[model samples]
Target: MTNELPVISLFAGAGGLDCAVERCAEPPLVHDGSGSPLRVRVATDYDGTALQTLARNFPHTKTILEDIRTVSTSDLLKVAGLSKGEPTLVVGGPPCTPFSKSGFWIEEKRNSQDPNASLLDEYVRVVSEAQPEAFVLENVQGLTYRTHQEQLRRLITGLRESGYSVEYKVLLAAEYGVPQLRRRVFVVGRRDGKPFHFPPITHSGESERDREYDPSKLPFVGVKEVFDGLPATPENGEIADGTFGELAAEVPPGQNYLWHTDRYGGRPVFKWRSRYWTFLLRLDPDRPSTTVQAQPGPWVGPFHWENVPNADGEMRARRLRVPELKRIMTFPDEFEFIGDRREVQRQIGNAVPVELGKVVIRALMEQMGYLDPLGDGARPEQVQETLLF
Candidate 1:
């Protein structure tokens, strides 16, 4: 172990994983880990906004905003001021849409090489070539589906064949402190025989460990807890222009779209019907959120507070906003995205939650002997900046 835990980031969406790793074990609280401060020396991604965000947040690091398939192992470490055999960490996830639980059903040949689905192989290629001491792969829970289960099985087997000890599991974001109920599949591998451990869930409301733990136990962060401090003003300010015509004209507070129309005396009005009524009805706020889809169409939307009904006397189902989405993904408020609204949403929705990554990384670091359990003093400084394009 050295003074800096060098890192190589792949498919680094909006640098959420990088930011989270940087903020893993900072001041005030100390972490019991085995690795040095995780340093993201090299971050590579195809998306311009994502790469720019990574660069903006980690100016000292080398960012390659190009197709990762063409990126060679030497090129990655060379830019990071390192060489082969140096202890380094590689982390990233291939686009998990095909394996996502909410993705379109692929009833055909699962082996078909869709450009997006085959990207997982590229990740494995980099791991083999770079030969990092350890690596982390994150993805949507869909990777565990029965249809695409073989792909995941192959990925784990491939890592082990490459001479690494690998571990993986599906994790709930709320269990790690994020307000949103997002779940993801995480995989870790170490070239050395030492086994890697996943972080334990520390914040379940019903988990007996909540009361059994000491006062220093981590607190459960909820939706209200995350958004409580934000301003009450709407981002669009009630759609004042009424661009959506009558639908927008009488749009109730917190309501985004209407599925039905009503006409009064010489006036046409619109009505809102909750989409996916059954799913919305079962949203147990006391527990974690259901999976957040890439496109939160009418049927599945983020629910408002239970008792806090909107102006129409109906609880409006609105998609989670960008900042809220980022928070839900466990990205620090300081980290920014560099892209259009749609791209931003896609990145956040498609990303690995930061807090969850931190816990995983912390566990690995501890195994490598990098963290100080007892507060030893100065830790890395986390900067506050908008990294999104």
Candidate 2:
């Protein structure tokens, strides 16, 4: 029998989570002395642009460029060379916009004829049909909000009825070594009655409210820790060429346009506290970054705080370059993104943080007895040393 467990990925945008699962069975990150890494037999995604990016990075995997609704469990299993009872793991992050509080409310969207609302159902259908030994579903934390409790209940019930014991938690990416404060909900299910335990937090922030201070944990990585080494922007850094550019110049690091004053050259065109929190937001060098939005508007941000010397030697602000954003998302530098500027940003922003994914999958591996529980797995140093870029 093969030592490596096969994996089937769905809605695998840019394969950030897949990359993490793949690494669990590979070098420095590998916990068990397994002969080969986890085999990603098949991956499916509906977005052509995202599929292109996934195929580019994982050329060896059989990437199905089709909607998950149209693909059958038998087809996925056949492609993966697995039988009904074979050991396998299915992982995916369904489209979150339907349930994202940042977007539309789930209840309101459910009342409307939103096509994406049924995506969670489709994900459940695949798991039911495949009946894998275990499955992991990732989604926006809004799924667990009190207002969406009914939806959450139905989801858990549906998975349980499919013969799996499930547990879920909202995980902060920064606590898991990612340099961004992105919290995502992960639902893990095992058909064999085994309960899934989350991995312990490996990092903490200075703020008491951020997390309980633990001397054993590493301090949260700051924006400067990652961005300082990159190339500097031009003196008149490339601004967004509109009102955004005008407002961005006035906002300082760690603050948004809302903090702009009507003094000096700064013009306060926007009403104070009227704009969304993301507008003209700049990263703070000392703190972890805010969540990276899937589509950053001409004015909205998670923008960089990089300053360039203007003609008068004055410092000026500029929006972050795509590469800098990718780093914030925890993608390896060498990982290629194959799309136009907007499409690439969407793929990167929509991805699971690579470090977060590694932590989750490593926990699953240990739970399944595939790896030694006591093994020194998924250390930040090991991840950093093994990063291709």
Candidate 3:
């Protein structure tokens, strides 16, 4: 009567994708009408800070702070209480800088040290050894760029050779109720020879799709829809300080507090001057947030809230608080984040949006016949109707 599904995670940065997968696998759903909860027993990451954070949050899972590339297949399997070729699921994302647009944005040796950069090879190595029933790969949207086309093709070929039927697509975080407008590439593969199917899109945007998506059936998700009704934090006392300044400060309604306080107090917003201000301008409350950068330095936004303009023509706001940023990334209020403000921001920015992962995993499970929509109380007609929109 146990409904527990075994999962082994690699490159498990701050447990974002694992959190989503764990959430989707928990009771009220993943329960096989039994009370025993689904569980993720093993996770690994090379970063000490990330490992510590993962340990603090997911106390149930065993975490290893070691480079996944060096971890043998036997080492990983022993940690998971299983041997190679046992039926289980593997989920992970290689460190993405080498495969990212910003990474190739410049041609330099520094950008090439992408440790997780060789991570895809490690992923394939693990898949071949573990022989899991299914696997999921997460990465930056930049992976699909022209520069990485060949590397991607090779990864696909490797998975097929390992006996997996694979499919991939670029998924936007906003489409799954994350307030931020982040996009990532996902590769889902199964060992059963069934082609992986992408989850239906539940949100849309102004950008024209290659094929027109049904607006009525698959309604567009918006910024307001996700973060709306969430209470705003008042600009006041500092909660945590960072290189930018105090975690909290008071500025006009729509002005860039980061710009005003970045070693140049009382200065005009970024719109007025341009030096040292490379981050996106204040977050547009009316629209979804632009891509959240991995590192938000001085002159970069901790970002303003709501983008409200003041009488002086400067926008009033402060850097994004840790709570708000988590909300933007679609982390539930109860999902506690650990660490300093900067590290927290990095983790949140780097995580897979939980809602997006939920749909994708559900679709994959359906293709495997391991899950039935009707069993979950979702009627076939209703599923089709939801898909149309």
Candidate 4:
């Protein structure tokens, strides 16, 4: 059973979490005493584009491109080659739009009865029916807001009644090695009544620094660190030649268009602080990026603080390329995304950072007594090429 623990991945967008699981099963993360690595028995998603990306990256795994609501546990088990009572692991991050802070504030759609909001129930249904040895559920932190606390309680209670011990926490992705400040909630459940320990933070910032300063806490990764080596490009591949591009040039690093002034030919079209922070937001180069949106507007930001020398030797601003965005999201350089530009942005933005996934799953493995103490000493670079085609 060294590398055969069956895994069923639901809503597997671009297979980010799946990639992390695969990495953990094989390398430095999983050494001599670790239990068998998880094998992707089946991966399911309703989005055709996402499934295409998953297939491109994980050609060996069986993928189901169908709505979860229409799929039965028996069918999933059949595909996974697992018996009804066999040990298995189910993992998913259902679309969080329904319970997202942005979605919750959208007056008309705030009702919990909205179809999208009910997908959590679908996730629970699948876990109850599958009766897996363990399961991992991930979602946006807004789900734990006081308004949605009842839903959270019901979810935990339902899982407990179903015979799995459940524990949860809101985890910061930056702490887990992702180069952004993304907070997500994770719920882990096990059939054997074992409690899951959340992984300790491996990276910290000024806030954490005020507490006990541990020598092991690495400094937070900055935007500059990730982008320093790549060649510079403008809004559409070269220097920005449009009005919006010109405005971006005037905005300084770390500041948004709000800093623009009439003296510099800039106009205040929008009221101050009225727009979302992403509007004209530029990266600081010294700090981790703000959250990457799944769908950024034509002028929305967390835009790169990229600049290239002009004829006079002055630097000018430009938008981030698709590849740069992927790097910021912590996706492997070799991971191939399949879709039009907009769709690709959505897929990447919606994905769980692979680094964060590795930390969380490693914690789960340890808590379940599946970890071996011996070191494999194999790094990610050594194994990534073999895992992705």
Candidate 5:
């Protein structure tokens, strides 16, 4: 491996996977991974809004705003000022909507005909042409479901044919120290055909892991810790009027609509297990929150733990503010977004938790003989900025 790892991001929605690779560059971070910093040279995506956010956050990386299917890998490398096989890593999390658990409700999405399913091939196309030393592909856990065997198999076969060794796992974000319990599948490949090491689990909660491992392990991060000093005051502090409006307040912290069912002692307005778990869900300050969806319904939650007083002076639960959302998503506190409130939510929700990405890249760097994943050393300065844009 060279002293620097040049990275190219494809289908780079809000640069989440790129952010992870960059974090790995700053080795010896909290989870103990160390290595030479990664340089993000170019990012390509069709959504201009998301590209804008990625551009502003990573000003040095060249940004190409176009559908990937129309863009050739040669153009991607050229924009980054690199020739074929010059890049050290290519990282991206192709949009996973059609492969999501929620998409199953729309039966057309259950089949491979959905256009989004084909984007996985776009990722493989770049790996075949650009031929980076390594690559990482991320998507929803449902992509691994038996129903989607064709798509998964095609992805694996394409990479293997590209002269690489493939390894993957469904990673839990909370287990890597993120405040939310988001889960996704990460597939890694090395051109040399050597197996890759996924990072070790660095966090565990009392209930999630065995009791005996408790003493030496770090507990899973909770929402409270993530939002410690942020004020509950958001642009819209008033709770929106909806079916669960004032009623969300009735449910205590660390619970959801299940609290309203007969089994849990609320008003019993709902049957047992009647709705999605996120319905009327409130944050449990003491534990990790559930998966953060790209588009949550009006009554869906993991709402802020703090309650606000209504006109009658009674308290009511409120939605999470934008800043809180960014924190929970594991983006830096000062990170900026380029869209309106709703779009920003989608960007944050769709991002790969940055810290988790760092862990994975650390493992990749270690395989290349650059990391000390268990070291206590401090993070070094970022690599020289790639002024490709």
Candidate 6:
């Protein structure tokens, strides 16, 4: 029996979790002859631009464009073609701006006061009402910070009241082969109260300190490798042309504005620790990209490594294009973004990397007996996806 799991997605920006969970739903073994074990039934979000993109990518899912606060749990189930308690899985990350680690990194104000903070409750509310076999909650790692401990306590208590045995951890996206260093927290719950096994790190750093990981693990994917072959328009020469823009090309790959800092062994063009870490960040071909920003300033970057010439033939470093960002974020090559440039980038920045979600969701399914192991003895998670377009 397929015994399909009906998946409902909330705060479903750009369908990153949906993409990964979709991969998990597909039966891994060919001869098993079972249909997909999980199905995404509905994806709901407040942003029309984001829902527009989600609908295009996941047309199989019913899209509801409404604020989660106003969207009733019964309505959500009905839209998913499900009755209460009939769903297999529900997944989403409420908007994380309230808990994001920006200037408010340690601010006590990063609490339930912000209007966005209420969205977390909305996630728990839906899961409580739907009573799925399991639910996954994604958010910025900052939620686990000491200042927000009260909220975290309430969240755990809220889910446990509904009989969920919850497990959570801060996961590194690069460790799962996404070509970027993104840190996020995932909270998973099982209605059966069985212990849930989070995905293991199948990829690791090559450094000696990283030897603690299983040696057979693959190296963390590099940005250059992920961008091996993609189209670009250096002729248009979207050069980093502000005051520091001209210096972007000179800073060398993988180094940021700190490249010119005295402490970093370069000429002290700027004071040590004077700028934000991302002020002039450039990609290192051999390293995974730093976390991309939702609203990067003109000079903020993990800028492209290959300096390209403008129409005048002057070679200069340029900001990353949409195509490269998608690869780094593990969005498939053909997936289309439905908004203007800034809005599109914001969706990508806010998403859980598709590969990272796939690793976690697949492991969860396998451990829970929803997925079968390969006859050849290799688990589905063992087979890494290139995620190439």
TM-score, every prediction = 0.75, 0.86, 0.78, 0.85, 0.90, 0.88
lDDT for each residue of candidate 6 in 261-341, tens digit (9 for 90 to 100)? 777755679887887888888888898898988888888888888787655776678878888888998877878998767
Q: lDDT per model, in order?
A: 0.63, 0.76, 0.65, 0.74, 0.80, 0.78
Task: Give candidate 5 misplaced runs (Cα > 4 Å).
Answer: 1-3, 25-36, 206-215, 311-314, 372-389
How would the candidate models be sorted by lDDT, starting from the highest? 5, 6, 2, 4, 3, 1
TM-score quality measure for candidate 2: 0.86
lDDT score, candidate 1, position 244: 30
Worst 10 residues of 6 by lDDT: 26-35
Candidate 1 runs further than 4 Å off: 27-36, 108-115, 205-220, 237-288, 306-319, 374-389
For every candidate, C-alpha RMSD to the true structure in Å:
8.5, 6.1, 6.8, 6.2, 4.8, 5.8
Across 84-134, the per-residue lDDT of candidate 5 in tens digits comes to 988889999888987898868787787756788989999999999999989
Most TM-score-accurate candidate: 5
Model 5, residue 236: displacement in angstroms? Answer: 1.7
| lDDT of candidate model 2 versus the reference | 0.76
Query: What is the alpha-carbon lDDT for the whole of candidate 1?
Result: 0.63
Clashes of 3: 12
Instruction: Choose 1 or 2, whichever is better by lDDT.
Output: 2
**Leading candidate by lDDT:** 5
Error of 6 at 167 (Å): 0.3
Q: What is the per-residue lDDT of model 2 for residues 1-389, given as tens digits with 9 covering 90 to 100?
A: 33557889999988988877776643332223332246678899988888888888888778888888889889888987887757378899998886775655445664433567577888888888888889989998878877667667878988999999999999988887788888899999999887899988888885314546678888888878877677764423355554455567667788887676454235667676777888888888888888888887777777767655445665556667777777777776777998776777789889998778877887787666565556544233233333332
Model 4 lDDT on a 0 to 1 scale: 0.74
What ordering of candidates by TM-score runs from best to worst?
Answer: 5, 6, 2, 4, 3, 1
Instruction: Provide the global lDDT of candidate 6 against the true structure.
Output: 0.78
